[model samples]
Target: MPATAYDAKGLLKSAIRGDDPVIYYEHKRLYRWIKEDLPEEDFTVPIGRAAMRKEGSDITVVSYGLMYHRSLEAVSALEKEGISAELIDMRTLSPWDREIIFESVRKTSRVVLVQESSKTGGVMAEVSAAITEEMFDYLDAPVTRVCGLDVPAIPFAPPMEHFFLPNADKIARTVKKVLEY
Candidate 1:
């Protein structure tokens, strides 16, 4: 069965009440979502690890999941506009590589979180809050988030799906605004 908001709420309640480790399915998806390119002997890519896609002094694009691919494309487009962006793929969410993100934020001081979720109370909120709370002084611009508008995702129609997801154009625009701050 597909996950629902109710299910997530119940899971959280149970975990809190029980106070025990809960191996959530969300973790499994990231672990196996993309086929590992590393050697078989060293199969571990290390969950909670952050990998840098590009290095730049202008701005940093932080993203994960399918959004990670989209950010890379945006980086290419931004390059044509004479904007250099560094992309970081945060594979694991729970044990996210805060050190990597903090270091990059301290260096560039501009961050745009790209996530394919509702803009309201989404995972991007947590990231933005953390950055502001922990590395506020390092930032030159306000941390911005590029997320799908508050709407449900469509399964079949291309146009509807497009409307439900954050595209490269939206990301590029958000990045430009962040740079201006």
Candidate 2:
């Protein structure tokens, strides 16, 4: 999920009726930005499945939450530069969609994982590890991570917060670096 309001209700319903615990991380920044019309009937988006927002062949960009939107922006920029990027939204972070990720990497031969969490021990670390362990032979370049700085706490000021967080520019830069490698 891209942390949009469209799937919020479904995620909530899934959490309530799920057999095991579900940890949903709501992005505070998306609260005011994302709005959508949801279905009137009750629905649940299953956990552990990733949504492929865009299809491409050059590189694969895997992300979740706010970073997913940012990754799309970066993908758009890359598209302008003649680089096709496949964007995947890992809705469930705990049980990430390994099948989709492996397939994309196998086809594109390059990948970059974007996240807003701190770089140290962030979710991307596990994703990178998985790719290295399972898809090493498919990779043309090393897995790149576009993540927040290794800060103890997020900054309160807008400027500082922007600096600490991963944005489209940062993601695009990382994608370019990975492509060059």
Checking candidate 2 for backbone clashes, the offending pairs are 1-91
By TM-score, the best candidate is 2
Displacement of residue 180 (Cα, Å) in model 1 is 2.0
In candidate 1, what are the lDDT values of residues 54-165, reduced to their tens digit? 8878998998767876788898899999999988877656667899888999989999998887988877789899999999999999999999888655444888777678
Model 2 TM-score, all chains together: 0.94
Please give, for residues 1-181, the per-residue lDDT of candidate 2 as tens digits: 4366766777777877988977777887788898898888878877787888899999999999989889989999989999999999998887889999999999999999998989989889999999999999999999999999998888989999989999999999999999999
Q: Write down the lDDT of every candidate, Cα atoms only.
A: 0.75, 0.89
RMSD of each: 7.3, 1.3
State the displacement of the C-alpha of residue 178, model 1, in Å, after optimal TM-score superposition: 1.3
- Cα deviation of 57, candidate 1, in Å: 0.7
Per-prediction tally of clashes: 0, 1
Q: In model 1, where is the ten-residue run with the lowest total lDDT?
A: 1-10
